[model samples]
Target: MMNESHAGTARAALPLSWAKRGLVSLFDSALVGGRPQQRYFAALGMAEDEIFTGYDAVDNGYFAQQAETVRVDAAACRRTHQLPPRYFLSLGRFVPKKNLPALIHAYRLFLNANPQSETHLVMVGAGPEDFQLRAQCVKLGLQVHEKSHIPERAPASGKWEQQRGSKPGVHFYGFRQIKENPLFYALAEAFILPSLYEEWGLVVNEAMASGLPVIVSERAGCAEDLLEKGFPENATFTSISVRRAGLRSKIRRNGFVFDPHSPEELSRVLGLLSSVAELRIAMGRASRVIVEKFSCENFGRNAWLAAQAAIEKQRSPAPAPARGELMIPPA
Candidate 1:
């Protein structure tokens, strides 16, 4: 049921057959991939009865651990340097689908609109698309800085500065360690994941737990459920409305939805966020409250329970071989 990245291609190719077989259930962690797979499975005669219930992974214990870490890191960051009141951070692959280009464009707009704002954008993660994304950001007038002596090379001081003659507000910290990532999140004012597609987007949950407001795409499955719970009021949208106008109108009031292709809209939202410090703080606090129900321990427990239920269902004996005349043939 877990549609891991490695198996996605094969599963995509046999959508119909997989649905008919009914053994496979697609659990989309990346929000972008889940919706399409759900539709495909439905088309192949797999009813809601055959699929798993609920989408968000709940884990209370992990949340507690993460919360403690976030508090410590946030305090340490405040003591070390005078950090901005608010900033944006993202953690994902530097790929096209992750939508770095649009993010860069939107950030550029945000900076231009508020030249005096102290907001910063921090991006982490490496992929084949890193160079292209970096190049695009530079072209859009956002400054890029490579973190010299990465963990693979040597011990890093975790210190970074603005590049010379670059725009006043943009920064890029390339290839940071996983352990150091939480520190980045702790120092940020908000988390922005403007991905074109995602299956479940656990990073959003992590951001929420870190007490950071999240601005994610509607294409993410987590958004659908998270929005319902009313967490992270600042989680903006960047996708077309799949629902008709009626439903879209109802959801639009809950979050800011923009066309993923339009950097202007994205910039406008960021600019608005940057201008209002209280807004970010309120949204961040709200996000933390909303994600309390989605902890890692809860997720693990629920997954185990679901598996047990499925097993028990299978163990029950089938009804007597339906009026068959030759039930014991060749026995």
Candidate 2:
């Protein structure tokens, strides 16, 4: 969207050459919205060096430290949030783009598929679409379901007992303090971001940092970066090719990417996460491990390199080679 402004009337007076190069930060995928954005920049007369990939990143230290801080009182959070031992979590603004409706629908689907699975859905965040989401929840029978009171006390095992008669449903906690988010991630069995079209999602990074497995849409920028080639358990022994080979395997993936915004796909993925504890642990580890490669430090370094390349390109005062000519293989 920032690129669109460069072509705006506000910048009409600036010479094209004087524009030099601009940096656009992109998240982890080369597909989805990536290709179109690149074409836009190229059409705007940006050369390869002029536009550099600055990936989306977050403070790993902050999440890591917060995770420890929150873990101290995790059970309290679970009770306060009315969360089960295992639940799928989605956090984002209540906007259409975030696709909260689809998530709710998928949650319904999950419950229908696994009527006995006590797993729940927790959505945190408030937005313009708030009323509609609540309405949808009500219509789906999630909001007004029958409930048998769960006892306030914990069992001998130390885990909270499930509500005997209440149906599993979405727990809508409107916007929460950012500081409390780590606790939410820590409590969740897995994190889900089913955005219809999100260029980059920082919450995915945060969830990964908190060591929760994630399920994001194919269009999410972080999906591939966090999912495709996450940190190898043994880099010394396992080749990247081997890792890629097992991307869809439950043992290897941090999450699964779904297509074209379907509730069924999201539902199926959620059901998978709900069914297996081992899968959740492995994927959560993978997400956290992969995120290290996309740290804020890495973003800064990549941006600096791009700027230097652009500055040098601008200063060279030489004619750029023709596009068609440059693509030809040399004899």
Candidate 3:
């Protein structure tokens, strides 16, 4: 049998306890989402070959194709959708665990520091936190526009100078279908997922496949495998590291990773990406390169390998009974 781990905190400990007692081998094989989970199982006594990585996946090719189609008429698509010309995208539920409030606060910080900047923060998805998140935007003096209310001729850049009683900073585009997501992914400068905790953010894969650089929170499960030059577990982005290397130097080759709890780090990262157009282009390309490895083909191949390995193990003869040990024959 091959099993995937998706248990929550309390339930997850049961397997660890079993593994500690040398019982984990009861399963023929196991698969994990990424290296982070792989390290966790390895630490719990799972063997290297018994564990497969990259089990969580999405149809990268589909999203890539959709994004390409949208790119052909990107300008018109933006107008039809009432989307800002250049903005960072956040696509996920508006739940507390997403830490959207922190993202909004960081965007505020970035705006305060870069007053002349015109890049908006476009949020797509609705959940319990919708009302609260919108309220937070209002409190921070950042205008919130629902998808329907956005002007047809939304400004290509800068504040909503043309639209009266409207500000252009944070947009709540509401929920989008899977097919419609590529439009936003295709047009955005970059994608961001600032979840406080996520088992595996498939949206990260979608964004990467759509050729958008990502700014993911370190706590996201995909952060380790999907982010280029995966964030160092021990690498602290404290004020000390920021000063020593400078902000530009800290930008990872693929994208940025920040502490979800630290709005300051997220703010600085936003500023860095916004100022470096060349870097964004390069990083977006890098995202495509990295995500290609997690394609549906690779996922199927890994599953086949696990099944083959498990079958071979099952066909092998059982270990001979030890001295003074009783063995029961198969019924």
Candidate with the greatest TM-score versus the true structure = 3
**Scored by CA lDDT, what does every candidate get?**
0.57, 0.64, 0.76
> What's model 2's TM-score?
0.72
- Over the stretch 69-169, how does candidate 1's per-residue lDDT look in tens digits? 76666655643433334568878887777888888878888788788876777777878876677677667766655543343454243333334443344
Show where candidate 2 strays beyond 4 Å: 1-45, 49-51, 144-166, 229-252, 318-331
TM-score of each: 0.69, 0.72, 0.82
lDDT of prediction 2: 0.64
Candidate 3 residue 176 C-alpha distance from true site, Å: 1.5
Which ten-residue region of model 2 has the weakest summed lDDT?
Answer: 25-34
TM-score of 1: 0.69
Per-residue lDDT tens digits of candidate 3, residues 16-79? 4554325454556666788877766666566678778768888988999999999999889987
- Residue 43 in candidate 1 has what lDDT? 56
Candidate 2 lDDT over 114-197, as tens digits, reads 788888777778889867877787788774221112223332321222234445666666677787688778888888888876
Clashing pairs in 2: none
Clashing pairs in 3: none
